[model samples]
Target: MKTKFNTSKFLAIVFIAGAITLSSCSNDDEDNNVVPELEVKTVEDLDGSQGPVFFSLSTGTAVQESATTWDIKFNSSNFSFGNGAEGQVIEGIFENYVVAPASGYSADDLAGIGSLYTYTGQAASGAQHAVLPTPGRILVVKTHDNKYAKIELISYYVGNPDTNSEAFINLETRPQSRVYTFNYVVQPDGSTNLK
Candidate 1:
């Protein structure tokens, strides 16, 4: 018995395969560039030894720290705060307690301060490089390799083991007071604009 080639069957198979492939490709648009949603890193347990603790923020990574690296207090009131070694300089008055942004706010946008770590208003006296409870301050930091980043302060209090599940350090005074939690994004090319 000789088997004859079926043109209709071959054409139907090709058409179905082509349709399937085309449908799959049609679902996605190649031209629309997507910006990744950066995260709000909760950095905790900072060193309270009256010095500058340096770190980097490249990809909006979360930070939870305890020990500090440097030994100089970088006040934000001056232009040349930390010289060059340290990257970030934060200074502001503390609230009754620190908290995250209310809602409907983009952490990526830094339009209010104009530039990173540039304060708009003066905090009260006894203000240092501590995280402010409200979202009115921006901390400008240079990465270990000289990359610039802006961190929005979220909170400055430690979380209780059984309650208040925000971002916990260990305590709320002195050494633990130096601890901080905030959201941050890095500018790889050291751009002045944060957004």
Candidate 2:
């Protein structure tokens, strides 16, 4: 017995296969363009007297200052990049920034000295002398390993209290200082494409 070829059935199968292939290709493209979820972490009560609190953006955790894998450090209110690492504070909202710049990253000399926040002196902050995070300040950093990460300085006080509220304005009710809360994204691919 010989089997007969059905043209209509064969055409239908080919069309279906083509549609499935096109759908898969479209999904692949979408996946490539999708942005990764941002990582939010906080370093609590960094005391300069006790030394700096080192952090690793790649691992999204605080590391030992002496650890070779650390990427950045926080001493009191000051922060600095690890060896071979550099970064700058860009003026913009964190969510608005998409890609990291190609150049102009700094390691030390002036890494975290008033780069992300400003001091609300006795007369400046309405009887509340505190350090406040500057509005629209975003920190973009290049890890010591050459990977890129962008940071958003959230709060200098513990619990991330509302800075504008009366509770935050009152020095007695305000949260403790030296707490660093921020959101960051690390491009593990070592490319400037932060998306």
The top-ranked prediction according to TM-score is: 2
What TM-score would each prediction reach against the true structure? Answer: 0.41, 0.78
- In candidate 1, stretches whose alpha carbon ends up further than 4 angstroms from where it belongs are 1-4, 22-39, 58-131, 136-148, 156-177, 187-195
Provide the overall lDDT of each model, using Cα atoms, as 2-decimal numbers: 0.41, 0.77
Residue 192 of model 2 has an lDDT of 85
The segments of candidate 2 whose C-alpha lies over 4 angstroms from its true place after superposition are 1-50, 111-114, 124-127
Which digits, one per residue and each the tens of the lDDT, describe model 2 over residues 29-124? Answer: 999999776555555444434556788887777777777778778777777778688888898887778789999987764545467877867755
Per-prediction backbone clash count: 5, 0
Among these predictions, the greatest lDDT belongs to: 2
Report lDDT (Cα) of residue 73, candidate 2. Answer: 82
